[model samples]
Target: MSIQVGDTLPDVEIRVVSNGIEEGRTGPLFAGRKVVLFAVPGAFTPTCSNRHLPGYVQHLAQFQARGVEVMCLAVNDAYVMQAWAASQNVPPELLMLADGNGNFTKAMGLELDGNAYGMGLRARRFALYAENGVVKALQVEAPGEFRVSTAEAILEALA
Candidate 1:
């Protein structure tokens, strides 16, 4: 089953580029803080690059104003995530995380099989709000849709 509102996020290893690519875990990242993490199927994909990520970038400050940290995740490698972040001019406050092996994605039951499109296991387009490691809200989109997982939608959910 997919992770739900009361679920404590699985502690799984992930990669983030801090001076260089470094290992981190989900549990500590979400512990003692409110976080809004949004996942895309891949980095630099058309919809993700043009719309999904930009929405978050534009509204990042608004999220922070509510005491929530914003994060963008993809199944790509840490190098690709870093490049994408630089290309997008993403602020340092908005974390760019890589789930290269999809361990965390699978653990959350949010893995998307994109073999038909030549993409491998990937993360479904979704976003979740958590407080102190416990999920408080989740919005998952339907296949080929991009409706509920946008930054505005999550902000509305928070309200």
Candidate 2:
């Protein structure tokens, strides 16, 4: 089933990079904290690079001030995610997570069919507000739309 509000995030392993590449479980990462996790179809795509990710990056402080940890999740590999982070000059406070094999994306039932685009398996654009591992609010954008998943929308939902 698709994850929804009031559901505990699946305890699936997702990859992240700090001093070096590391793996973290979704449950532990979302535990005991308020988190805003947003996913893009892929890194470096026009909408993702120009808007989705940047929206969160630009308003990062606002999210932090409200005591929320902001994260960007994508189906790309750690190397691609790391390069995108560096190219965008993403702040240390914001985390970029890679669901290398689409394990987490598939687990959440948010995988997009990218076969037509030659991208293979990818994540559908979405965002969620989770507190202590339970989802409080969730937004899944319609294809080719950028409304509900933006930082502004998520912030408003939090309010």
Candidate 3:
């Protein structure tokens, strides 16, 4: 089943580009903190680069002002994530996570099959809010749609 409100985030290894691709678990990242994690189907894709990620980048301070750490996750590797971040001019505080191998995506039951697109396994476009390791809200988009998972939408939901 897909993760829902009140579910504790699954423990899984994720990679982040810190001093050259440091690895860590999902547990401590959400433990004792409020987090807004949004995933894209792929990095550098048209919609993701133009709308999804840039929305978060534009409104990052609003989320931070609400005491939430914003994260952008994709199934790509840390190197790609780092390059994307640099290309987008992402702020240092906004984390870029690499869910390589789709472990975390599968654990959350949010994996998207993109074999037809020649993309292989990828993450569905979605966003979630969590506090102290427990999910509070989740917004998943319909296939080929981008509605409820936007930064503005998530902030409005939090409000």
Candidate 4:
């Protein structure tokens, strides 16, 4: 089953670029914090690049004003995520995490098969509001839908 709002986030290894290359765990990242974690199917995809990611980047300060750490996650590798962040010119405060092995995505039961497009296993588009490692709210979109996971929607929910 997919993770529910009341579920504690599972500890899964993910990658990030810091100093050089580094591996980190979700549990530690969410520990003692309120996080706005959003996932996309892949990096550099049209919808993801143009809309999804830009929404977060644009409304980042609003999230932070509410004491939320904004994060963008995808099933791509650390290198790809890092490069995408740079290309998007995302602020440093927004965390870009890579679920390269799909471990975190599978653990959350959010993995999507994109083999038809040769993308392999990837994350479905979704967003979660988590606090202290426990999920407070979760919004998952239907396939090819981008309605509820947008930054504006989540910000409205918070308000």
The number of the candidate with the highest lDDT is 3
Assess each prediction's global lDDT (C-alpha) against the native: 0.93, 0.91, 0.94, 0.92
Q: How many residue pairs clash in each candidate?
A: 0, 0, 0, 0
Q: Score residue 142 of candidate 3 by CA lDDT.
A: 98
Residue 114 C-alpha lDDT in model 1: 99
- Provide the RMSD of all predictions against the true structure, rounded to 1 decimal: 0.9, 1.0, 0.9, 1.1
Name the better of 2 and 3 by lDDT: 3
Question: Please, what are the lDDT tens digits per residue for candidate 3 over residues 80-120?
Answer: 99999989989888899899899999999999999999999
TM match of model 1 to true structure: 0.97
Give me candidate 3's TM-score against the actual structure. 0.97
Off by over 4 Å in 3: 18-20
TM-scores of all models? 0.97, 0.97, 0.97, 0.97
Name the 10 consecutive residues with the lowest summed lDDT in model 4. Answer: 14-23
Candidate 4 — what's its lDDT? 0.92
Task: Estimate, for each residue in 1-159, the C-alpha lDDT of model 4 and write its tens digit.
Answer: 999999999998888653345788889989999999999999999999999999999999999999999988999999999989989988888889899999999999999999998999999999999999999999999999999999999999889
Scanning candidate 2 in windows of ten residues, the lowest lDDT window is: 17-26
